[model samples]
Target: MTSTRATVDHYERLAASHDHNWTHSGVFLDWMTSQIVSAASIGATDRVADVGSGTGLFARHIADQVHPAQPILCVDTSRPMLTQIPTSPEPQPVVAPAEEMAEWVTAGGGAGTAGELDVILLKESVHTR
Candidate 1:
């Protein structure tokens, strides 16, 4: 059986390339992302969590829609994947598996002035849930 740790290690190894590969998805990704963001109706005061946030593509996209001070927690099992997120307002990289994300957040991982997450975008991570 494939263990979770082994899967995480694989993602760590592929983090950089993962970000690069998303570019090839092209307009499909952009359109899908736009639809998600639009439907999320994220407010400036909303705290957001992007679980399984590899390279923070979805988190980065939503950063602009949320408040400048609102925290966007980027939780992933792979540290290398979290590191791939480009510098922006401020991306909180929490290294943890999807299963433990709720506990981590409860322990103040993603807590901001606005409190807990108002919006959470799981995207391809639905399986993890």
Candidate 2:
């Protein structure tokens, strides 16, 4: 099993260059993002939480789908990696391991489980904790 500590440490080391290493051509990113957004049927009004939102590789692209006034919760364990995400399009960073994501969002994340977040995108960081 993959330890959560190991996963967080691994990502922490790669934080500085995470975006550069994962990013592809604009066309490719757009295409990929479109596929995910479409598959999820994300709408402008949907409350979205992007778990493991490393460098916002997908979060940034899905911004337009969620309302401009609202913010996408970018959850990641690595602070440096979250910092790498751009400010534009507006993402609120939540520093928490993937396993704790749900608790953070609903309990401490201030959104309240009122209706629950409409969408949660858990791309790439599904470690066995």
Candidate 3:
């Protein structure tokens, strides 16, 4: 198993360059947007939580698919990655670890139940979870 410390270190190291690479890569951006849009369409009204939401790319793409003003939490352990997310006067970004996600939701008055999500996007970071 990958230790928590190691995982954090790995992500922290990569976070700085992740956004740059993704931003310039058209293929990756297209694929990510497609995936997020598809996921959002299936779970129309529920709040979405994106784990390892690096730079909020997927989260931002799916924002319009959700309710006009519903919340979407973007969780990432790396502050640098979170900082790189494109600014949107619309969707907000939150920086936190994926493992602590349940607490973050409950604190926001959500049910905190597994599979209760209308949409839970793991994206390309599922292996980290």
Candidate 4:
């Protein structure tokens, strides 16, 4: 497993350029994210958590499917990466490792029970950790 500190350091270094780099994903990202959201059965009442949320690109896209109050938890190891997430109504940014994602989810007013999360999304950010 990757050490949390190393993971954080690596993402911190990349945070500034993350959005630009992600632009290449473009239409593919849109299609992939749509499929994931549809398959996950995410709804307005469901509490969604985007693990390894990076700059919240996927989180924001997924948020569009849910209501503003549903909340999309943006969990990332690097604070810099979290900060790169554009200001949005649905994404609630949390600086934490993937293992601690549940804790952050509960703290954010989610159901806090196993299998209670509506969606736990991991884009290209998981392999780094």
The most accurate candidate by TM-score is 2
lDDT of 2 at 8: 71
lDDT of 2 by residue, 1-129 (tens): 234777778878988888788557988888888898889998877778888787877888888544534677788777888998877656778777666776655564554323367789988765555
Clashes of each: 0, 0, 0, 0
lDDT of 3 at 118: 60
Per-candidate local distance difference test: 0.70, 0.75, 0.63, 0.73
lDDT of 4 by residue, 17-101 (tens): 9888755566777787778778888777776778888888888877765563556888777789889877766588887777666
Structure candidate 4, residue pairs in collision:
none
Better of 1 and 3 by TM-score: 1
Clashes of 2: 0
Q: Candidate 3 regions off by >4 Å?
A: 1-3, 23-28, 39-45, 64-68, 107-117, 126-129
What tens digits encode model 1's per-residue C-alpha lDDT throughout 1-129? 122666766786888798677654756666676787779887666777888787888777667545436558887777888898877666778777766777655675533433366777786662422
Cα deviation at 108, candidate 2, in Å, is: 8.1
Q: What TM-score does candidate 4 reach? A: 0.77
Stretches off by above 4 angstroms in model 2 are 1-6, 64-67, 105-115, 126-128
C-alpha lDDT of candidate 3 relative to the true structure: 0.63
Off by over 4 Å in 1: 1-3, 23-26, 65-68, 106-115, 126-129
Q: Model 3 Cα displacement at 54 (Å)?
A: 1.5
